[model samples]
Target: MAISIQIDRVSREYGPVKALDDVTLDIRAGEFFTLLGSSGCGKSSLLKLIGGFDRQTSGRVAFDGKDVGNLPANRRPVNTVFQSLALFPHMSVAQNVGYGLRLRGLSGSTLETRISGALDLVELSGFGQRDVNLLSGGQRQRVALARALVMEPGILLLDEPLTGLDERLRQQMRDEFGRLHKRTGATFILVTHNQDEALSLSDRMAVMHRGRIEQVDAPARFFEAPANAFVARFVGIDTLLRPERIVATGNHAEATIAGQTLPVRVEGPADLAASVVAIRPDRLFLAPQGMPPALTLMVVGTTFRGLHRDLKLAFSDGQTLVIAIEADADIGQLSAGQQVSVGLKPDAAVLISSAGLPPA
Candidate 1:
């Protein structure tokens, strides 16, 4: 059965350093969740607390409302697939997959059946007898996944399992993870520093920084309406303009920037000084020849990006914003210091706080 997790005011201290600082989070049963952040962000520390490999110094770690902080790793209904994979290279793939079952006294046809089933689940149906040492990187990754799934734990923890794989294999394994999550209705908690991995695999994800959660929400929410400026930058919304003046009107606003006014979207009452305009690159375009332009800025630079070209435009005050245009689009005449008209789609410019907000 899948298990729900409750981490209430969890704090993990190592001497003077606090790896996890009063963190509180709830994960639903059978949902795919990701803990995302850069290194040393307490994501791995929190995972250790959940897996029972390490206990919290203060606060409670619960599974389905029952405290499990005192339980050892083996006693908890959890299994982890670490980045190292830790496969027994001397053993055959089948032996590695069935090692846990054998330790629990499972043998004969029963053990073989479980091993075969696990291998089949990871699409490694007939390679059981092959030596694990000779397998390719991706195949070895599958073997590790098979070993973890074979345990049938209620909660599966993936700790950077795709860390060392090449880009193509990483993508392949990422899709495999999504497929496995659906095949087995276990609560999946993934810890990854890679944003692409977290954004693609998680049903919902938490962004952690400096031993605290910055924000928690679905992937699209992060792109559409980030919690604050830090999250806006993290999710690829790089253009944040501090408007010289702003006029409020319900959920919409008009912000004056570079001597021109542009329509901006807002969630609630916005403080003119505290809020900044977040411009999404996808929402920017070249001004229509017959229509009035929102703002006319000087082109500072351009970079070729295969399918698209990134144009860097600078305001009068030297503030720069990058917008992508089609590679084949006619803009060869545009050069540095040349003035070009740009248009912003309605509600494309979001008014967000310049400061970081508390995690939700």
Candidate 2:
């Protein structure tokens, strides 16, 4: 059975420091939802609150509209697969997978059958007899997942479950986990700092900054249409351009960069006092033809990335912009300190609001 979860104004504090501040979110039934943020941003705290591992100071957490904030961790219908894997060193894979059920006093052939079934669900059917220490990192992770899955909890909280794995293993586990989610129909809430992992694995993601959620959206929309400066920056737009240069009428805006004014769409106005037009590296291009008379810049440097070349340019007025162009393009003709015209097509950039509130 699929279960839905609601987090209501959940706040957690450590002495005077607030880990989570008035946080509220609704996780859909059986959806793979991710809480994404940098460390100390309360992503883990929020996960802990949902797991019943931590209690909210002022708010409530509920399952399908029933309050669960006061319930103990064990009493909640949830299970967590921590980052450490936390498998007992001496135990075999089957022992670990059956630990929770065993704790509930289940044993013998029934336990054996359930453990075997859970192993199969994670695609590790025959590995139950293997020592956990003998399994590969990815296998151990699956074992941890199996342990959580076998419990048959309504919700599964995964805390950076792939943090230590190499890139290849991480990606493999990511795909496998998605498959597991589909097969089980259990709500999976994963927490991680890896943007790629969150974007790739989550059906929907919440981008958190400080102690609050900046925005929550499906992967495609979140990548293409960020809600704010923090989301834009954190979600992978690293370059910046002056916002005033962008003149907004409504859904559309024209930005003046170098000597050129290019049109773009503004999702909405932001609270930032300063705005910088943003673009992902892949959105930018290099053209042999000089930029329109309206745009001009001096090439500063270029770096070769296997798939593309990264170009750094500086406007005569001392502003800098970075653009990535095709690797085999005629970027070689451009050198340091050479003046060049730059242009941005309407679909190539986004306007991001800078920090609107002044530093206290």
Candidate 3:
């Protein structure tokens, strides 16, 4: 069964500091939603509130339209897969997966069948008799997942489950989780600091900062329409012009840096003279004769990144800009210590606010 969850102005305080500050969010039924942020940013605190492991200091948590703030962990129809896996050292994979079922007073062939089905869902069929210690890291992870699934919780919370896995295994587990979500149709709330993982895996995610919800949107929209400056930098926008260098001109603006002034697109109110300009690397182009240059930069460094060439340029003021050029581009002749004319399309430049906005 799938369930929707709501966090209404939830806050968690530890004496003097507040871990979560008047945070509000909604998770749709059967969606794979993620809470993404750096450490001590209240992402984990909010997750704990949802899992019923920790109570909020104020506000409400509701599941499937019922107030669940008072519900104990055992009474909630939710299960959490922790980063540690927490598998039994002496138990076989089968026994570990069936641990919850046995605790719930389920036994006989029905319990065995359920355990087998759970293991098969994670693609670990026929490995039930193997000792957990003998299983590989990925296999053990699958077993841990199997244990959680066997309980058939309405919602599943995964707390950095892949953080301990190697690169290859992490990717494999990502695919496995995607498959499991599609198969089960249960709401999944995942916590992670890996932006790539959050973008690739989630249907929609909430980006948190300093115990506040910075932005909540689909990965594409979050990248394209960052609510503020923090998200712009965190989401891979490489070129940021200091507010002092930005001169407003209605919907468009100009950035003057390193003795070079370039045209930019302005967003929101014009009252902010200290607002910054964020530009994605892919948006920059090498201007030829027909097209005029928007910004001129001195090439400081270059890195060959297989599919593309990463060019590092510096403004006259010593600030840096990174541009991604296609591998086959004419930049083949370009090098460091060279002055080049760069062009930025109107929509490529975004004026992001210096601070995050509350969810609208």
Best by TM-score: 1
lDDT of 3 by residue, 285-355 (tens): 77886677887888997888899988888888787888888877777567788988888765677776756
Candidate 2 lDDT score at position 198:
92
Ranking 2 against 3 by lDDT, winner: 3
Model 1 pairs in collision: none
- Candidate 3: lDDT of 130? 97
In angstroms, give how far residue 306 of model 2 lies from its true place: 2.7
lDDT of 2 by residue, 66-156 (tens): 9997799988889999989899899999999999999999999999999999998888989989999989998999999999999998898
User: Lowest summed lDDT over 10 consecutive residues: which window, candidate 2?
Assistant: 351-360
Model 2 quality (TM-score): 0.91
Whose lDDT is higher: candidate 1's or candidate 3's? Answer: 1
Candidate ranking under lDDT, highest first, comes to 1, 3, 2
After superposing candidate 3, which stretches have Cα over 4 Å from the reference?
A: 243-269, 327-337, 356-360
For all predicted structures, in order, the TM-scores are 0.94, 0.91, 0.90
**Regarding TM-score, does 1 or 2 come out ahead?**
1
**Backbone clashes, candidate 3:** 1
